[model samples]
Target: MATNQQLTTIKCLILDHFITFNELSSIISYTPDLRRLHFSHRHERDTTIGSMSSIGLTNLTYLSLRIFSLNFHDFEIFIGKIQSKLITLSVNISPNDITYLDAYRWERLILQHLSQLERFSFQYPDSVDNEHRYFEGLNQFCSPFWIKRQWIFDVKIVDEGIVYVIHPYKKRCMSSIALTNLTYLSLRIFSLNFHDFEIFIGKIHSKLITLSVNISSNDITYLDAYRWERLILQHLPQLERFSFQYLDHVDNEHRYFEGLNQFCSPFWIKRRWIFDVKIVDEGIVYVVHPYK
Candidate 1:
């Protein structure tokens, strides 16, 4: 005889295989204090998970779904059953099944259902050959509200063809929830326009204490380090540590190296700041520390 005692005290549930709607409901009903739920399905099987009329997860604070084969309609239906004030929500879907317009719908659905959400992350499997096109699509998919909320955002290029964006949840000013507890930022991107970079950095400038960025050598050809120095000085006055890494040969005779020296030498000599350079893996790392 299988005793039902274990399900009553379950607070966290992680389901990786296919489950029917009735099974899901039974699990929920058994676990009244469930606080976290994660469902991940990586295979491309056409599995039918039946739907429930109404299901409430009053105690659920974290939810994550990584179903690459689920279509938009099915996903919407499955998510509609969840009624929880989730603090963190992460979803990963297939690129083939979602578009830029669909992202807007996802945003609206999240705002409607997870009203008290404090952290959100979304990603899709990138289509291998369309890096530039995928980048443009991902940017278009981002919500304006998220941009204004100072999300610690990122779009990484990886071998598995994955696009990721993560940010803190948006909340009303009266709410006791604090802003993102982030103080350091690190970015590795194929390319970023100067204006876009400036706008992105401005969002977290108030609390940022350290920054590290790795830009492609080709992207930095047109960038003016002196102009960037001015921008950093003006916007990130409280920033105490900074580092930049890139894959460009920087011998003593290189004009780029000279340019970097020209931009940072004044800050070090006049402000008693510390600037150091290191060569690593056929690249360079430039680090700057504020004067103590």
Candidate 2:
């Protein structure tokens, strides 16, 4: 039972239930000035309601949805009703709810509906056994679009086997877009191959100041420290700080740090950079700072 004064004063709202279309409409109608809205549905429930009327939230700036079970059509219809010039939008959906086709449709709907969007993020739940395949699928079908907008791109792997690929914009790029406004990038990946790494770094045209990466080693052995130093110096000439974390390997002898002394000795002598290395429980942490 929200009073008119309370509704008018509400700037943020969170709904976590099987809310119907009409119910959601009524709620939005009440909160005329709402700036942010978050909805989460972790369980299946009856979402039946009367009417398909659209409602606009002209003042809303942020929207998020964490959905476990919702049809794509329903989700699309729900968003179609709200007219908001959102600056940020995040969607986390169960993999079961969306296919690659649905992902394409989502991209189109987002670009069409939220014309003023500046930042966007998306995530699909993954299991340990299928994580690699899931990422591989994304690599094949998903094209990088956020680079054109100079938006932050983040991929986080949680301990619970959840993989999140969050970027600040939507759309699939037909070709490479130079990252002119990006200044910092942080990546946490299971394994990054050398060619992929080179291609990824070559896209940044801005004067990047900081970079951090946590990588799990794969069979590829080209990601040595010397190679990394060369790539950074060549691509990111204005880099001021670099942080690298390596996940431990089962065979300690073949671990990346085995050649650390060789890599650091030459890097220390040749480059005007100051760096430190630490052996932590998770793995090794290497921090490098510009000598200036």
Candidate 3:
């Protein structure tokens, strides 16, 4: 139960250990004007925890769920009960003892339900192939009956698809899901393979003016000239800035710098004052007009 009713008017609720999703959902049901709700819970021994009815959060604009113990079937049952008026949804699935998704199951279970979703942030711990659900979700968003055509705001993809999409995988399936209205994008991929960069650039060629990438030290060595050309310079015709960080102390400082000179375009990178590609002891981070 909530501690005070006065806080209810506050509109945002974040619950950690003590609160159950069922109780939290009910509390939000009472607060019609609530805008944000974030909750994390592990699957206890009992399967019956949260509600299956629409939460009636008609005023909700943001929702974050860090579900730990949730199983595949439980996810299906709970999502229907979890309704949101949200324009942004951030979900992190850190599975414990269960494997809930394959490619097909991901399409049917998660993406099918998020009809009105716009801005999205997602993180996953295991294999990245499941992260294709973003595109799957985007498909539903673009469906004539779902959200309006030009509604999404930002798309942030985190460490989940590093292996499959950013590593060795050549064709990022999500690249085809058109984000006609996206303004801001933040990506931190873990894979060293340059092919993922191809998929990243291929998917977001037109709508992106601002881009951020976090390349870890482990994956930094594999970055090569051709990959940089294909992913960063060629695809982003409208790119105004380029910011990059090297994750590892690879022996190719001369090679990488030469590649940056040869392949990188000053027409766009120089024009965008925010573009920066520098090395740091910890790792490399490139930020491009992060605001928009």
Collision count of model 1: 0
- Show where candidate 3 strays beyond 4 Å: 1-8, 49-52, 97-100, 127-292
In model 3, the Cα lDDT at residue 288 comes to: 31
Positional deviation of residue 290's Cα in model 2 after best superposition, in angstroms:
21
On lDDT, who's better, 1 or 3? 1
Q: Which scores greater on lDDT, model 2 or model 3?
A: 2
lDDT of each: 0.64, 0.66, 0.54
- Candidate 2 pairs with clashing backbones: 120-168
- Candidate 3 structure quality by residue, lDDT tens digits, 1-292: 2345533565887776544556565566567678887887656654454443566567777887877767766666666666654567776777442334233453464466666666655544544564334433334333432233233223345664321111111233573656767656666667545565566567753666666666653544334534554565566656554555445444435334444443345544445434446566644433333324
For candidate 2, write residues 16-42 as lDDT tens digits.
765655566767777888999987754
The predictions' CA RMSDs to the true structure, in order, are 9.8, 10.4, 13.8
Clashes of each: 0, 1, 3
Clashing pairs in 3: 217-247, 243-286, 245-284
Candidate with top lDDT is 2
Q: Which parts of model 2 have CA positions greater than 4 angstroms off?
A: 1-7, 16-18, 42-50, 100-103, 128-136, 140-144, 150-164, 169-292
| lDDT tens per residue, model 1, 193-241 | 6666666666553566777777764545323656666767877766667
Sorted by lDDT, highest first, which candidate order results? 2, 1, 3
Candidate 3: C-alpha RMSD after superposition = 13.8
